[model samples]
Target chain A: MTVLVTGVGVVLPGGGRLADLGRTEAGSLEPVDPRSRINRRGLRYKDRATQLAFCAAEEALNDAGLYAPAAEAPVRAEIGIVVSSNFGNLDTVCRVTGTIGAEGTLAASPMDLPNASSNVIASSLAIRFGLAGANLMLCSGATSGLDALSWGRRLITAGRCRQVLVLGTEPDNETVREFTDTPRMLDGAVGVVLEDAGTAAARGAVPRLTLGTACRGGTLADCVAVLAAHGAPARWYPPEAVTADVLDGLFPGATRVDLAQVWGASSGALGVLQCAAAIGWFDGGGAGPVYAVTGGGRDSAAGHVFTAPPGVAR
Target chain B: MSAVIAGAGAVSSVGRSVDDIFTSLCGGRSGVGDLRVFDRTRYRAEHAYEMDDRPPGGPDVPLRTTRWLLAAIEQAARSGGLGDDLEGVPVLVGTGLRELRSVELRHRGAADIGPADLHFGPAVRERFGATEIHTLANACAASLSALALGADLLDAGEADAVVVAGTDMITESMFGLVERVSAVPPDRVRPFDRDRLGAVMGEGACAVVLRRSADARPALGVLRGVGINCDAYHVTAPSPAGMAAAMRQAYQRADRSPTETDLVMLHGTGTMLNDEAEATALTEVFGDRAGRPLMTAIKSMTGHTSGASGLLGLIVALRSLHTGAVPPTLGLENPVPEAAPLRIVTELVEGPSLSTAQINAFGFGGINAVAIVERAR
Candidate 1:
């Protein structure tokens, strides 16, 4: 019943396309419309969150080589979609609520109501790709991204879907501003394609790692400790572990990467950034096990332990 | 995969607990009363089933809605005989108003609010000690969506048990929205009646403890499947032809035909457009067999509970399956002339063992959700 991750794609504050995100960028991370570059029209109406999801989904499908033709092939109808966000469509919500509050009730615009929905991203993707399987949106604050990942793994392990597109997305808005005074509300998306070991091997897909047991703890400290016991590097810490003293306690030898410098201090998008960091470290031919901790003040934490591939130095 | 309703609870104008509400319902009592939830002197709708009994505190309950939500969850846990603390249990709450009161207070300049003041997710977490909590704001369909997602979590093995709650209280802001939509009536809600004008507003909260069938107690019914569909046609009005796709999807997922259903718990908001569309959808889907499934509209008695309507209907369906009798549809003296020839239940009648029931909840944003529940032998 174990699920394996075959591919990972990300659109984050670190800039670059999904393929280039993991590698060193020549310049700073900048926001670019991947859809526009790809000549996809009518994408202007989509918010940054939806755009991020499209970019990541496109990249993941490309990496897995699951094109429209392949998706429409005579395979089982078993592709589930699980998308999660903390402040889902916060930008849209703020706009709608502000409009309703400022203007008279009768004057409230209807254009923004659809965008305020938490499931808009997933629903849009499903309609675009004709994915008629299970679709769910999880909004559990900081842990939402991991929750989606867990559900995707479960779908594969339970034989409900041959593969699942687990997306983690967040768009910057006033809600993010209220959470952190700093501009941490970065916009990004990451999608991981999960499949069972049998299906993966049948398709000649080499899994990067076996998705392991995910447990929720009462607090971030407890979560970190549990992950550490399961082989997570002790140097990793929660997002709040940014204080100098806490950083000293966690990462002793590693030089800190100022994530805020590239992507703001947003909570939900941190998971995508962390996933990007893990992929970056792996692509750089790093050795041993690298731990990625993503969570915030909501007491939500997801620890991912990445072990180097064989022949990679420890 | 089967999902069992391990525990259920409700806090409405009908009653605060399941047993209390069931007794009142069986006795054919109505919960409709004066509209005290807001200043109704200026409004046309002056009657509703407003929950006036506060739980040991005033309006300052962190998130005002969370107080009622906690009570319902606690009742569900108690009824299910679960002793485990909800330390790590995922919480999914369906609410049309995520602290609507708080927003009103801020708008009136009665209180200064922060980001946390905008919603109920954090308040529920603090009250129930959930490991993770999610809030769904799909209007009337919110609770059904929460239940559907919770069932998915169990089916996917995400959690051993989940607490899914739906809560909303009457708010002036929401009333304004209702007034604008022309869905609010001047007095009591009368569903499926020829003289029905519109729906009266009400407020309530309901929760269900969902678990895998293997882990649940033997007495509860089984949640067979749930189907959800959204019509991108309009934000306020339903799809012109009705949610035919959603109905088909529900039956398809349940592995049953419209003829196999024993009862249909209609949304029956008493709104002219809503009732007509529902009747058309039913006739189109079921045809001659539409009358075979005994139909009842509970909103006539309880008023429109908004987000809690889905769970309220779920509770009533469970009761019907247990008692082998369907509750009467109140306030339907004369059926609409154009309505389908369905067997509208006007008086409670003992019938054959009801095997399956379908509950539908349509929201403001064209969100349609239907859940099929089966009697667990």
Candidate 2:
């Protein structure tokens, strides 16, 4: 029941073109037309969030090497899609509700109603890929994306699904304009494929070289203590903990990679960016356990322990 | 420890309590009527199922939806026979079409939208004194998904008890969307009926408490199994294949055949497409046994509560088990040919004490979820 991360896909700020996460400059999300990247027709109805998730899902599935139909004619593995977002479908909400509030309900666009759902982005991906398993969306806050990844692992380990496409999506919107105007918001989508260890090996896909840890119902200090027990994490990717400088005092020498430095401290897609960057660095031969922690409005923190597993060629 | 339903509560267009909704539904009462919450003269479909009792939020308080949610959650927690102090427990809330009323009020210069009231998680955290909260917005099936996730957490020994809730409010956008798509009934919602035109828009909130079976005292119903999947067929249309797969998955997870189940609570949105597709899915899953298990639809009276719809149906199932009689599916005078053979409970059907019942919740974006509840052993 060991759940392993096999592949990942990321769509970050600066228009989905990533020369490198570490070196990339932080800025608001640049325009990336999903129509050009999606290669599908009839996408005009879909919102930008859905399109971004679709684009990222495609890349992650391709990286996983298990996108082929599993014996069935067209049905894929009962792979579920779990998406996390703080401001999902806000643009659609603002536009639709605004129109209705102004000119009455008759003025609202019917097409916009469905797009204002937090889960539509996930369902959009499922419809395209034929993934007819459990579809869930977590809409807590910043750490929800990390919660989604941990929950994806649990879903696979519990035998609910053989595979799961875990995504964290946030599109540019006016709802959090002031926050983004400052330095705590970014928009885009990031995805990862979680699969069984045996399945990943059989598919000849190099697993996301690593180990990971998940714990719920703990304070910030407790979270760091739990991570401390696992042996001081080599590199840090802490989002909520950044408000407090205790991490530096605890593990001063560990190279702390500030995601805000790369993603403008935006809570929306920052954690996912941190995750993608950590995995990218791991895949690129960065050594030791890559620390990733996120805790937002909720009391508990979600932590991940990543290291290249022994004898696995990635 | 197994996840079990210890208590339940709901506030639909029909009634404010689980007993009120289920009893009214059992007695054949229709809640659909003219919309009084707002002006409906501009819309084609003027009638709707609106909440009679308004939550307390005038020019002073912001986020009317949060008030409704808190009321329903408090009611559910109390009715679950548990004490009021639910501090530090994990909370997962499924919400639909949020912030419309607040935004409208702000637009009208009536009240300023407070920061604490904007996010559902923080609102619930502050109101209930909860440390952890998660909001799920997956359309009508959100509550069922949240319940499924809570069950998973309980099964994994993550929490001793969890509160899963769903809430939605009747907004201009919701009603307008149905009218725009021509998915609104002219007068009343006739679920699975021959003359059923479309679904009627309605809104409400529902909450349920689940605790580890080993820990829950005097549990009412046990969470037997759950199966959730995306139709992947279309966003708004139902997929027979996906629906059948989900039903099959649920029964398999329960380690029992469909025949073993006693009753079914249907999504039955009253739309022609939804009813026919649901009938087709039942036939595909049950085969010759399609007509065996007695099924009932509550949406005829409850209307479609969007994200909160499934939990209202869950409450109905619990009441059926408790009363030992199935609630009647009002407005179902003539059954569709696709569902003729199946026992669509249009009348108050008396049977053996309900042992198990399955609830189906489907929504836009092809989101499908099934949850099985069984009488505690």
TM-score for the A-chain in each candidate structure? 0.82, 0.89
Tens-place lDDT per residue, model 1, A1-314, is 66766777777654554445433332554665666533375356666777778777767766665635323443224676777665556555545444455654455443444464445676555544444355556555555566566667755665446788778777766655654455555667777777877888789875654555565665666666766676535233246335656545654454444443445554555554554555556556655355555553554556555554333345
- Tell me the TM-score of candidate 2's A chain: 0.89
- Residues A197-279, candidate 2, lDDT per residue (tens digit)? 88777767777744477654445665667777888767878764355555567555678777665665445455566667777
Could you give the C-alpha RMSD of every candidate to the true structure, in order shown? Answer: 5.2, 3.1
Separate DockQ for every predicted complex: 0.17, 0.51
Residue-level lDDT tens digits of model 1 in B1-377: 57888888888888888877776666667788876644444455567777776444444323456678878888887776564367667778887655556545544454465544444555665666666676666567778877777877887767788888888876555564455455435477788898887877777788888877545356567787776655534445665343665677678766778888898888888888778777878888888887788888888777888777888888778888888877778888888864648787888768668989989887764667788888868
Docking class of 1: incorrect
Q: How far does residue B219 in candidate 1 sit from its true spot (Å)?
A: 3.0
Query: Where's the lowest-lDDT run of ten residues in candidate 1 chain A?
Result: A67-76
Stretches off by above 4 angstroms in model 2 are A15-19, A27-29, A68-73, A175-185, A217-219, A240-250, A265-268, A298-301, A309-314, B55-62, B79-82, B98-111, B114-119, B183-185, B214-216
What is each predicted model's overall lDDT from 0 to 1?
0.66, 0.73
Q: Looking at model 1 chain B, which ten-residue stretch has the lowest summed lDDT?
A: B54-63
Q: What interface root-mean-square deviation (Å) does model 1 yield?
A: 5.1
